[model samples]
Target: MYDSLWKALKKLPLLPRRLNYAKAPALRFLDLPEDIVYEIVHHLDIRSLCNLSLTCRQLYLSLLIPHLHQQKLPDPFREIHLNGDNCTAAIPALRLLLYDSPIKAFTWRAGHDPRTLVREVEQLRRLIARMSAIEYLELDFSNNWPANEFRHGHENGYWAWVRLATNLLHVVAQRCRVVVVTNHYQVLVPWVTFIGGVPYNLDPPLLARMCAEWRASAGEAEALGSTKLMKSPSKISLSHPDNAPASATFPQPFPPEKGSTVYATRRLIVNDPGLFQRSLFGEWALDWVSNMPLTHLVIHQGRMRLPLLRQLRLPRLTSLVISHG
Candidate 1:
C-alpha cells in the first residue's frame, strides 16, 4: 500500500522536488529554545532588557515571566539621588527609570535661583505624581543661595523662597509617605535644627510667651472639664544659643489618648542645641515634630520636657538616642 501511494504521488505534475535540509534558512534567535533565550536575557542589565522588550511582542511576553522579570529589575531599596547641572535636562530619563521601579527613597537638590528652582520642583512634582511606590522624599535647599541667607537671618528674599519650599513640601507630602525639608546634606534632622535662622536674642522671650499662653489656655480649658473642648497637647521645646537653661511646660498632664492615629517616623536626628529657641512666625519651632510619623528618634545636644516626651505617641519607635550638652 505504501509503494502504491508513493507511485501515485510521483505521477502528479504539481508535485515538487523534495527540499535539501542543508539549504533551509538558518534558525533565528527567536527560534531558539525558550530556556536558552531566557538564560541570555537574564544576563542583560535592566536598561538593555527594557530595550529588548520593546523590540517585539514575543520578547516582551517572555520578560513577563515572573522569575525572569524579578531578576532583571533594579533593587528598589537603594536610594536614588537627583542633582547636578544637567538634572533639569535629565528629568525625562529620571521619570522613565522610576516609572515602574520600586524605588522608595529620592533626594532632590534645589539649585541657586528661585525661578529656576521652582521649575525644577514642578518637574519633580510631575514625576512623583506618577510614582506611587516612592515612600520617602527629601528636598535639599542647601544649594539655594537664599536658603543660606534665611538660615543666618540675613533676610534677602528669604521669606519668599521659604514659602516656596513650604508649599513644595505640602504638595510632596500628599504623595510621599515621609517628606523631609533640610538645608544640610543630611536627609533627616530635628525640627528645631531645620529652623536655625531665628534670632538668638529673642529665643528666651519668645519661648516664655509661648509657654505662658499655653499654660493659661490649658488652665481655662481644664476648669470647664469639657473633654471635647480640651485641646490636644502640642510637642514644644526651646533652648538658647548662649546655653542658658530655657524650658516650657503645659499646665495639664498629657497622656496618650485611645484610638488616636499615630504616625511613625523611620529616623529622627536632632543635632542643634538651640533649634527650638525661637518661634517660627507665631508657632513653636518644633511644634511640627509631634505630627510626624516617628519610628527612630535621636536627640543630640537638644532638650525635651518630661511632659512633652510622655505625650508623644511613637508606636513604631525601636531606637532612641539622647545626649546632653
Candidate 2:
C-alpha cells in the first residue's frame, strides 16, 4: 500500500516548495534611518528643502529634527537680488521667500524683458500678500532705458509698468513702517509728482490718471485716520552717497508752533553728509528726518554741514556722533 501511494504521488507532478522566511516590508522614503535622512537634507538647498517638507508629515518632522540645528547648515538663499544678471533666478527665490522665509527688507530691479514684467509684478504682489508688514522696500524700474524704448513702441505699453509699480507702492506703503526707497530719479519722478512736490508731465495719460487716483487713495487713507498705514522709523541710516538726488531749492521750514511735525525716530544716522543737501531726494529724506524726535544723531565719513545739522530740533538729544570723513 505504501509503494502504491508513493507511485501515485510521483505521478502527480512535484509541487514547488514555499519558503518559510517572511517577505521584507517595502522600503519607504520616511522609513529611512534618521542619520541617512539628515545626510540627504544637508545636500539640499533652501528651495529643495522647502519642497521636501511638503511631501508628508513624517518627512516634515524629519526636516525639523534637532540634528539640523546642531549641524549649523548655511542657507545660500538668505539674501537674493533679482537684478538683471540674476533675473532668471527670481522664480526660485520668490518660492523660497513665499514658502520658507520672510525677509524684513527687499529690493528688486526691473529686467529688460517686457514679456516677464507683468509676471514679475504679479509675483511681487503675491509676495507682499504673504507679509504682515515690511520694514523697507525699494523698486528700481530704470533699466528700460533709451535702448529699450523702441521695444515698447506704443504709449500704452509703458503705462503697464508704471501702473504696476504705482499700485504696488500704494499697497506696500500701507503695511510698511520704515521707508519706501525709490533710488532711481526716473522712478522717483512719478512719486514726487504724486506728492505734488514736483511736476513731471508724463507722456502716458494712463500714468497721469493713475497718479491722480493714487493721490485720492492716499488722501482717503489719511482722512480715514489710518494712522497704522505707515509709522515713522525708530532708527534710520542713510549710507549710500551715490543715491542722493540732484540739487533743488528748499522752502523755509515752518515755525515749530505753526506747522512743525514730529516723528517717532529716536536715532538718525547719515553716513554721507551729502544726503542732507537741498536735492529732491536729499530734501525728501531730510524733511522727514528734521521732524524726528531724535535722541541720537550720527554723522560719518563726510564733511558735516553745521547749517543742515542745526535744522534738526532734537529735544531729547543725548548722543551725537560726528566721525571723521
Candidate 3:
C-alpha cells in the first residue's frame, strides 16, 4: 500500500523541489528587504513618491532619502508665463517661492523711456535672483530704448534697474553654474535681451553695460562668449501701413544661424512698427544680451526681395535664408 501511494503522488502535477523551496515563505511580505524595495520605489516619479509616502510606515521611511526624491513632480508645480503686457507672473506656486519655485525666466517688458525702463527693471531684478536653473529667459527691450539720463538720485528708479540687472545676472549665472555641476541636464533657456519701452526706444548703452557686467561675473573658462545670441525673424506684416507703404522697407535676405531660437514664423502681422520691433527684438533678446554674451548673428526668415524697402546691409550676418509664399 505504501509503494502504491508513493507512485500516485509522483504522478500528480507538482512543482519541482527547488522551485517549491524558493517560493516566498510566510511573513516575507512584512519583512521586505530595503534594497529591493528601494529599487522598486526609485522607479517612481514625484507623484509616486508622494503616494508611497502615504502608503505605510516602512515605505514612507525608505523614500525619505533626500537624494532620491529631490527632483520635481512630473507635473510642474507652477505655471509661469509672459502675459500680453509682458509682465512675468508665476501662477499658483507663490507659497513655494523660495522653496520649490525657483525663477526660471524673467523680463523687463516694454513700457517707458530707456531711463525709466532701466529703473523699472529693478523689481524684475530681485525676482531673477532666486532661480537656480533657468530654461528660457526673456530680457524684453532690444529695440528703441530712450537714451538720456542724469546721475541723479540713488533712489531714482533708473539707477536701480540697470545696476540691479547687472547684479542679478551674476547671481543667476552662479546659480546656473552650480546646477550644471550636479546634473547633466540638457536644458533650452530662451535668455531674452531687452529693456522696457512704452513711449521711447530701447537703451543700447544700458544693455551693453549689463552684458559687460554679466560676462565680468564669470571666472576664466566659465564665462560665456557671444555665440549665444538668437537671431531676429523676418518682417511679416498682415496689414500694410498706409503711411509706410509695402514699398517702404523690403524684406532683407537673411536666415537664422544654426542654433537660432527665433525661426519658423507661422503668421505675419504688423500693427505698429513699435509693436513689431518689440515683438521681434524687445525685452527677450536684450535680456539675453545682458545676462549672456552673444557673438554670432542670426537673421531669421528673409527673402531675396520684398516689395518694400530696398538695400539690405547686414554684413555681420552669417546665416541667410530667403522664403516666399
Candidate 4:
C-alpha cells in the first residue's frame, strides 16, 4: 500500500496545489530514505521525472545531478527521443545542455520549419563540437528536405550531412556507447527515387567509418579492462504485431560481448501507402549495425530483413531475442 501510494504520487501530474503535498504524510508516510528518493527519480520514466520535477525544486535538482542522472533509466527516458515535430523546442534545450553541461546522450530531429530543417545539419556540427562527454547518441531527421527551399538544392544536400557526420564521428570516436541516425518515415519512400541522386541522403561512407571507429575503440577498451556486454536492437517490437510476416522483419546479429546488454531499434514504421521494404535512406541501418561489434540484439518495431542471416554478419553473436519478430 505504501509503495503503491508513493508510485501514484510520483506518477501524478504535479500542479501548484500538489506541490503543497510534498509535506503531506502520504508522501512522507513511507518515509523513503534520501538515497532511495534519488534512485527512484533517476530510474523512473521521463513522465515520472516530469512529475517529480514539478513537485519541488529539490526533486528537480536531484534528477539532474550527474551521478544520479546516469542510473538505471526507465524505457521512455533511457534512449534519447526527439520526434520530428518537437525539434524546435527540443533543439534549444539540447543546445543549452550541449553548451553548458556534459550530457550523457543527446537525440536530434528536424522540426516542422523548412529553414530549421535546412540549418539543422549545421547546428549539429556546432552541437557535436561541444558535447564530448556524450556516451549514447541518436540522430533522426525529417524527410521534409524541401526541394524548392534548397540553395540550388546544394545547401540541403547529402554533402551537408557529410559535414555533420564528420564532426559527429570525430568527437564521438572518443567515448560513445551507441549512435543511431535515421529518417522518421524512411520506409514509406520507394527505392528508385534515390538512383543517380548524388548520395543525397545521409553520408553512407561517413557512417561506415564511424561504425568502424567505434568497433576499434570498443575493442581497445575491452582489451585494457574487464569487458562488459553491449546490447541494443531488442527483439520485442512495440509498433508491430506479434505475428507479423517474416518479410517484415530485419533483426540484427547478437550484440558484441562487452558493456551491459543494450536494445537498439533503428528503423521506420510506415503508415502511408506504397511502403517499400527498404528505406529512403537506403539500408544504412542494417549495414551500419552489421559493422558494429554489438551483442544481445533487441528491437521494438519496424520491418525486418533476412540478409542478416546470410549477407550481413556480426561475429560477436551471443544471445539472440525476438519479442515480436
lDDT of 2 by residue, 1-325 (tens): 9999999988997789987998898998777887898888878775687588768876655564332333332232233345554444434434433323333445566666645756676676656555544433445554444434434432333334444544454445444333323232333323222121111221234333433443334323312212232322212122222343556332322212213222333334433334455543344445455555455555542433567766666678887756552
Task: Give the TM-score (vs. native) of candidate 3.
Answer: 0.27
Measured against the true structure, the TM-scores of the candidates, in listed sequence, are: 0.39, 0.38, 0.27, 0.36
Evaluate model 2: give its TM-score: 0.38
Better of 1 and 4 by TM-score: 1
Q: Which scores better on lDDT, 1 or 4?
A: 1
- Evaluate all candidate structures by whole-model CA lDDT and list the values in order: 0.45, 0.45, 0.33, 0.41
lDDT of 3 by residue, 1-325 (tens): 9999999999999876763456565775337787877677668665555565656776555554332223222223222333223331221122123424433323233343334444344444454444433433434433333222222322223222333433433343433321111000000111122322221222335334433443334233232222222323323333333435766763321233335432211111111122212322223323333232222222222211132212233333333322211
RMSD of each: 17.3, 16.5, 21.5, 22.1
Q: Which residues of candidate 2, in runs, are more than 4 Å off?
A: 1-21, 25-50, 56-104, 111-115, 144-146, 149-163, 181-325
After best superposition, candidate 2 residue 142: deviation in angstroms? 2.7
What lDDT is obtained when candidate 4 is compared to the true structure? 0.41
Say which prediction, candidate 1 or candidate 2, comes out ahead on TM-score.
Answer: 1
Whole-model alpha-carbon lDDT for candidate 3: 0.33
Residue runs of model 3 more than 4 Å from their true location after superposition: 1-79, 83-96, 99-108, 112-120, 142-161, 175-325
